[model samples]
Target chain A: MKSKTIKASATATLINELDKALSDGFKPTLAIIFSSIKQDWKAVCNMLDERNIKVFGATTAGEFIDGDIEEGSIVVMLLDMNTAYFKLEFLETSEKTTFEDAKKLGSIGKKTFSNPAFILATGGIFIDGEHVIDGITEGFGSEVTVFGGMAGDDLIAEKPIVFTNNKSKDNAIVALIIDKDKIDVRGIASCGWEAIGTTKTVTKSEGNIVYTIDDKPALDTLMKYLGVEVKLDETQEIVAFLNSWYYPLQLERENGDTVIRATRFANQKERSLICTGSVAQGSKIKFSLPPDFDAIETVVSECKSIKDNPEQQADALIMFSCVSRHLSFGALMQEEIEQVQNIWNAPMVGFFTYGEYGRSKIGNNEFHNNACCVVALKEKA
Target chain B: MNQNLQTILDFIQQSKHLSEDEKATLTKAAKDADKALTISEFKLVRTEKVKRTTAILLEETIEELEHKRKAIEDSNNALQKSLKELKATQSQLIQSEKMASLGELTAGIAHEIQNPLNFVNNFSEVSKELLEEMQEELEEGNLEDVKEIANDVIQNLEKILHHGQRADGIVKGMLMHSRSNSGEKESVDINNLVDEYLRLAYHGLRSKDKSFNAKLETNYDDSIKTVNVVPQDIGRVVLNLITNAFYAVNEKNLLQETQGDKYEPTVSVATNTMKNNIEISVKDNGNGIPQKALDKIFQPFFTTKPTGQGTGLGLSLSYDIVKAHNGELKVETKEGQGTKFIIKIPII
Candidate 1:
């Protein structure tokens, strides 16, 4: 397998870059595009569709090509493989039929491809990414590899759009199915945030909205613990969202791996918290502390482990990094990407997401917030 | 060649090809060069010794600095621990001061109310005696019209006596609660103590908030006789719980008025006699404790009340007092619903 990444500021430039890649005898079978919300996604979709190029991608808060991070730029990763086959599917979902749509997408991939590794990107707003993962897992079972992220809209609170070669939709999911028998796939999800405070039990919650924690209004309790002044206004809600970026809640799973969930919205009328991922009632959670420099070491070390392997050489790396990390680490985020790049020296492309989805050390494909998920693909010889 | 100066002289004499001045010059130059070489070697040895001495001094200084840093760190840790202990003691002292002031106030109120109570009791007794004489005269057929009036007078005196005795009991309880605990255990009736504090706490809050009212109910286990306890301390615990109950209900009542909700504030005190221990529960239908604050309610300087409204020491002190008596104090609460504080003391 061979991969090439291109960064473009316009539809014409993106197509030109694609042509340049093709001229070099790199005939890509599948293209993964990560574009900023400022770009016209419809134009990009039409251009790629006219070329009869299969595509799957979403809008990003920021895009990464190789070791460089860019905002308001489009990045495309073109993959060409001799033995592997690729399929793309897109589905639209409403509040009532999100789970059903996810199940349908999962079953379609299951029937169409044998030994498939699924990559998913879903709409970020007003949907529980956890439930989508659950639906897919139910159809594909636990043995299959599932990984992806929720789309982000550049942190402007805009609607995140997902697309296929056929159409661009707002509340939609685009999935890529790769036959794993033709390629060796390895993934790792890591969040270096530490649990700082005492454990609290989730007393009342429904779907993604948490009404009460420890029998107190979830919002009030969170604000009190954070020492934030109590204000029941829109400004207060904004403050809560900003604070949650640094201090998200960490839930410990039965396998000892923790899943971080960040508050996406705060409901003042209901005095509730709506997170990017779903949390069940009676789950114990703790406020996470900001990561230290060692967290960067963790990401670098994990990448090094894969790159240092003597048996296989990785062809490409796809990263789904949480936007909160960008906010927290600032320029240090570049150093993290560069560290990984220094090791693999491969074609790497990814985008910052609202929430990440990947299989953890616990061996479960779970939804996460304020984390980094990396997928390394190689062809078995 | 110095073996000989003699050999050198002979050699110089044998050098027929050289002049005497040339030989003398060569000999002097060789001697001077040897002397300069010796001095240079000596300087090199001294310079090497200086460098070695400086290195040794640097190594010592580094070791000394490391030792000093460790000492400073140890001292800083000690200071931090001492500061923490001091803060804890300071909080305890503040609580004690509040309790002392409360004791003084209760004593003053009890003393002032006791005099008025005595007159009411004494006057009722005299009135009852006069009514009896009149009843005897009517029975003797000397005062038929006054007989019905005498019975009415007797009934009125009995009612006054009953209420007056209740007031007297409250005053006595206040006096007991105000007195400093002598650190001596006494076999005190647990039911009476709980009932006394319930009334005292109710009246205490009523004196502050005139519109505040709560239905006080008591269910005492008649089977529970006297149990050994520090009466004053136990009484304080009961008073703290009941006072908190009344405050909760009053706060809830205020909210109810604004929301147009129908809520009857109620505070109930109940005692149960168990095989090994006795349990006293003070419950109220008030805005309950928030669950996040429940675990910390007994921590010093932790309070939900606004500044100047609470010392944040009541529950902490109460917990300590209960523990000192080898008893357990536990609470159950639901947000916006109610709270129940249960005090369980061993029968021993």
Candidate 2:
């Protein structure tokens, strides 16, 4: 099996680039990471002329390369790992497959492979990617770990793309299969945000739109909380913060503040937060989470500690940081990257995801938002 | 020493010769340049490929999205159509409800008119017999007997005419109730209208339940001149008030009967000319409206009556008509006692 790593330097042909890279080395397997302002799939196809190698990739909110971050550029990495002992599974579906389907799909994996990993396309926007991932988890059932990102657009409420082994379509879900004994794979996921403020009551809501709060319109309630009138453009800014800092409620009994997590927002006349999950009809809520650096540092520390386990080792770290946290700590983004790099010495790749999800470290089958969840993949002993 | 090779390479150099280490460094330095060139060439060849793929994918995506968009649009149209239909149906129902109540009232008036016609027929036949007997007595030259008989005939005829006139007044009131009054102000004999409305209103109550009865009093300002007012409209107002009072009294009576309490329900109609206006009141000695329902009494479509019995528009329409006439309609009531609706229409 032949493997190679090919990357872009300027605006040129990816075919020639790949051909040149493949010419010198032994035949190699490929793993490409491309970040471009424009659609570069044609260039990608030039690289994939031969169906000899399986491909898996995602669009990044921002791409990192050469020890620095680059926007609107494509970075392709083709490894020379062997193609033997590895299998690639492609999932294409129009009908929304259920947990039963995910389990059925997951059951295809070995009871225990020397090294087994699963990558699924978490829906980019509006779709519940976590639920999809959870379905896959049900298939694996603590047998194998899972990792992937809900595909993304340019944060455009416009058309978003989800790539599979075949094509990109609007109503499509995809999953990639990476077999055991091919590569020692590692995955890390985190949003790097903490719960702060007081919990709020989602008094009256319909689907994703919250009509009233404490029996008043949600917009008025939020304005009263902040003690300022919200302008139109600022609505998105408010919603983004609300999604990151509010709605998936939790009670802080000592302070009497109920935390809320905003799952989605209904784009109606009155913009409202679609809570991550349903709230009880009369539940009281508040915006409460400590905006402390120590809270963030703790996540970094926790992610690093996963790497120290003798049974597990880190080869690659994938971080899906919440876009709100990305915006909140604009200049501090590098610090977050650095902190992670210091902890887990591995090749890191991921995006500033629109929303982040993973099972809570606190426990339960529940997925979380606002906070970074780390998934570390190590070769099986 | 290698100038010949360098010069020759400069002239004819395909420049492919270099050590592995040197080549590695050169490729590393030129990776970005190499990547761009490869991207451009790859893009040209792959452009066609991407176009086909994108077009096909776009068609599929747009088709799916269009299907969804169409579904949403269709549903919206359907919902709007349904809403409009609902509104139309509601208005039709309200109009039908009003017509139904009017039908019931007309039937009651027809029944009331039949009673007076019977009286006129009975009295006319009795006078015919008395007249024949008087003629025979006159032929026999008994003048005293004839005089007494003649007197009796005249008295009986007067009773017939009096009862006939009262029946005529009630029939006229009922007829006016059916007609939408011009509501135009005219020189109205306030005293007479009060007197006429009193009888019709009393009859309206009696028609509802034969047992229902009320006392009426009038202290008309005989000295005061007639006022400009809509007599027919005012009469209907009085009629409605009386009917409502009768209902209240009837309800009280029923409740008392059930409780074995023997208390006769009484409604009183009174009229007094004040300084600048005439005040007419219909008071019922029955359970008054609750405090909560008081304010809402004049609101359209509000009723304490069971369905099919009241249209609930009487007071509301009366309120509106009175307001238009620049008159005041006021109600004073107490629980377990009585209620009085006072109407003060000004005379200008």
Candidate 3:
């Protein structure tokens, strides 16, 4: 397989770059696009559709290639692989039907390839990402290779979309199902945040809305307990979790592992915190301080775990990094992304997401928040 | 003698054994690695600051949670104490309701016993006179007069015995109502039970207010043999319903006094054997329960009477007592005409 990456702030400039790359007699079968909602993503799909290339696209908080990251721009990884080895499927769902929808798609992927690996991008504000994981596991009758991210609308936090040619929806999931026999797909989800303080119980919550923790208002308790100050916009609501990203809640799981939960929005009048995923009432949780530089090292090292040695190479890389990392690490996030890209030295395309779906180290596939998920793909034959 | 890599590079640069271009590339590579190391060092320093702040936060949060746990424990202790006090108060209120009903029955019971006692006294006085007459006749050798006097004394003795038993039954019934629940069920005659409460309730009211009078009527169901029930609890219920019926009629009677209407205050109590239960109903031809107060008629502490007249627990307690027997208590009322309370107890 051969791959090339192109990025531009405008759809026309992106098309020009595509034209320049195509003129060199490089024929591509698929285009993986990550872009800001401000860009005309519809035009990019049309251009790719004319070229008979399958498009699996999502709106992003920030889009990046190997060397640099940009806002309000488009990044594309054009791959010239055998069409028989891969299929792109797009599915839409209602508020209460995301699990069933993902299950149906999973079954379809199973039927498409004897041994299929799914690369997914989802779009929904309140969808429990774990349901999708569990549903797919049930539909396929077992767990398989699954890697994806929750779509973001450039920090607007309103309507993130996952689109294909001529179809896009805020409540939908787009999958890239590849036959693992023809292509090797391996990935890792890494979060190296250390938990601080004793665990506190969530006193009251429903779904993603946390009402209280330790019998006090959940929002106030989060601030007071952590001694962290969060800034509010003119409406007295935290804007896009920009200030509180550094102090995410680490959910203590029964298996002795922890998953991160980043507060995405707030209800000041209700005195509640709205999270990217559900925090069950009575579940124990601890506050996490910002990760050190080792966080990047861990991500790169774990990505290398899929390979036999450090010198092993990948044809292409796709990353689903939680947007909280961007807000927390600020400029330091670049070093992490660059390091992960260096491991494979491949043409890479990725976007910072609302949440991520992949497998953490030493676990089954999972839904994660405030973690970086890197997927490396290369043809086996 | 030194074959170290750094030493080799130094010797090459000093002896001019390597090209400047080669030396420049190696130097650039070394500088790039150093620059990467520098970036890592900077991130490490920043992370140390984060650790210090996080340490402080953890200490403060752990302290606060400990304090909250202590306060919650204290609050729980206080709540437990309050609960114990509340239980005591509830039982006291139940007893007070019982004593209040017993007080209402006291006057009626005394008057009822007085009637039987009067009969006994009259019969004894007559018997004494007859005995003196018999003695005078015997002194005159009149056998026929002595025999007639003896027969009269025997008849008086029988009447005295009948009245004495009637007084005893009233006292025993009064005692049953005032006693605490024995938690036992017994077969009791429904007609006799209703009759006893009807008379006791009426006479009690009359003793309290001489001007308050109401006509009483009864229909006893002869077919109702016996019902297995907690006798004291059921007696309390019957007494409460009859008393309420009397109060209703008297209330109407007082209103009628001003209107000068030809209203005859009547309270009718009856017992009947239904399909599988004995139904006792006390009906009053007086003002009924108001529409707004209908729902709350069986709620504790909800009184239709002015303060101190009723305990507001009569119907509520009656409802619970009937429920304990797996029975039903129902009320039917009209706005201005009347109200009828029905109690149905399963006949065993």
lDDT (10s digit) by residue, model 2, range B69-178: 99999999999999999978755644454344445455455566677778788888999999999999999999999999999999889989987996787677656555
Order of all candidates by TM-score, from best down to worst?
3, 1, 2
Tens digits of per-residue lDDT for model 2, A72-178 = 55555555444554455545433245455556657665443444666554443455443555666777666465655544454543334445345554334445455
Candidate 1, residue B60: Cα displacement in angstroms equals 48
Q: For residues B110-161, could you state the per-residue lDDT of candidate 1 as single tens digits?
A: 5446655776777677667767777777777777647665766777677677
Can you give the lDDT of residue B194 in candidate 1? 81
Writing each residue's lDDT as its tens digit, candidate 3 over A266-381 gives: 77777788887778899898888877655777777887888777787799999998887876666677888998888899988999998899999887777888889999999995
Q: What is the DockQ score, from 0 to 1, of model 3?
A: 0.21
Chain A TM-score values for every predicted structure, listed in order: 0.93, 0.73, 0.94
Compared with the true structure, what per-residue lDDT tens digits does model 3 show for residues B10-95?
Answer: 65467666688888777566556555665566567667757766776878777887998999999999999999999788678778
Ranking by lDDT: 3, 1, 2
Off by over 4 Å in 2: A1-37, A49-51, A80-116, A142-144, A179-188, A204-213, A223-264, A275-285, A288-290, A293-296, A308-313, A364-366, A371-381, B1-348
What's model 1's lDDT at B226? 94
Candidate 3 global TM-score: 0.56
Tens-place lDDT digits, model 1, residues A38-150: 99767877777776667888999999998799999999988876533767888988655777888887788789777888888998487788878888877777777877888
Docking class of 3: incorrect
Candidate 3 overall lDDT versus native: 0.86
